[model samples]
Target: MGTLEDLTDALARDVIAAMDEIGDDRFFEKVSKLLLDMSPTTQEAYMTAIRVRLAERRARKYVEDALHAARAAKAKAPE
Candidate 1:
């Protein structure tokens, strides 16, 4: 059997992809509940992985938006 980390990470990625494909934002919560029934430790690890990935995605978007705005402002400024 794979380590807990590997299993949890893989599950997290698969759950995210499934959620995207199904267009259900609450899918993670459902999966978390299911995992809890099976194993609380696994559920917690999966939740942590999901949260970290989602947070990173949000952080990246913020950085991208800021960069775009900075470039637009620079373009508009006097040369």
Candidate 2:
């Protein structure tokens, strides 16, 4: 099985590819907004964990954004 780092790299690549395919500035803007909305304490905790170098915070951000989008899409879909 792949390690967490390997999985993170794969996810990051997927996110980048998805962004490239969509070619929409709003997609990124939405992600930025989400990041901004995160609590300062949460952000600080993430930064501290990432500073250890064992974790990839960027990958976490990508996954968080993707999950947010997925939830939004599901909410919008017909029940």
Candidate 3:
């Protein structure tokens, strides 16, 4: 079985991706329902965790894009 951390990461990533695709009103409804049912502490913890995961995802994408651009430039350079 996957660890708790692994499960959390996967679920959060999936939620973030879905939010990206959904309209604002639908996203607000779904997320508000999910979080509003939680206790205050639980809500804070989940928000913190998702924010961390999103930051990591953005950083990874930035690095990957930079590397790809550098590699393409290198390939096009004269030997």
Candidate 4:
């Protein structure tokens, strides 16, 4: 990625970390609004990064839950 892309991704990571630290789920939306007044391109990139990261986290959770359920079922099943 180029400088802007790198910077945008870094900022996105910081935003996510801050949201988790502060216990405010809508923090990114507030950041997005601020970015709107600054640079539309950067704002879009930041939003995209946020969306992708959130999606990945959700997907990972789904996979982990499924695995746990499968292991539990196996343990309960008769040999």
Candidate 5:
């Protein structure tokens, strides 16, 4: 429904602003509370999406870490 989509987008924007203001220490807490406030089906769907996003983040971080390590090794190698 349009109303549901509007509410979801509004909530996402507000939560993002709140997360920025609150900082990392409480960001997960804020999200967790948001999920807990939702219906079971909504919470499950949100959690699934969150998991996918987090996995993508981890994959990107792993690549970045590997590249950094390779650069460090190349810099330190015999030259």
Candidate 6:
């Protein structure tokens, strides 16, 4: 079994790979342009929504790291 750090790093790499497959920078640029073109109120709402979504994604990654740590600890524990 992999160490917790190793598993976490692998998962992060996988996430980056998936994002790359989806054209991450292009998506960000598009969203940024859309946000810039919106009215102030609309831009505020859109930015808030984007921030929430990003926070959720970060939270999910944190959970994944925690799970990996738990699994590694369990494996290393003596019977």
Q: Which candidate is the best by TM-score?
A: 4
> Of the pair 3 and 5, which is ahead by lDDT?
3
Candidate 1 regions off by >4 Å?
none
Give the TM-score ranking, best first.
4, 1, 3, 6, 5, 2
The C-alpha local distance difference test score for the whole of candidate 4 amounts to: 0.92
State how far residue 47 of model 3 sits from its true place (Å): 0.7
Evaluate candidate 4 by giving its C-alpha RMSD to the native, one decimal. 1.0
Clashing pairs for model 3 are none
For the record, the alpha-carbon RMSD of candidate 5 to the native fold, in angstroms, is: 4.2
lDDT of 6: 0.59
> Which pairs clash inside model 6?
none
TM-score of each: 0.87, 0.33, 0.66, 0.92, 0.56, 0.57
TM-score of candidate 1 against the unseen true structure:
0.87
Q: Please, what are the lDDT tens digits per residue for candidate 2 over residues 1-79?
A: 3454454444444445566799853353354345448655433443333343324646788899999999999999999
Is 1 or 4 the stronger prediction by TM-score? 4
TM-score of 2: 0.33
lDDT of each: 0.92, 0.53, 0.66, 0.92, 0.62, 0.59
lDDT of model 2, residue 32 = 34
How many clashes in each structure? 0, 0, 0, 0, 0, 0
lDDT by residue for model 3 over 1-79, one digit each (tens)? 3454465556566677787787342453465357658655444555555778768978999999999999999999999
Compose the digit string of candidate 6's lDDT tens values, residues 3-77. 544543444445445657986833543554665685554445444555555578799999999999999999999
Task: Provide the RMSD of all predictions against the true structure, rounded to 1 decimal.
Answer: 2.0, 16.1, 4.1, 1.0, 4.2, 13.4
- Of candidates 5 and 2, the better by TM-score: 5
- 2 or 3: which has the higher lDDT? 3
- Candidate with better TM-score, 1 vs 6: 1
Error of 1 at 14 (Å): 1.5
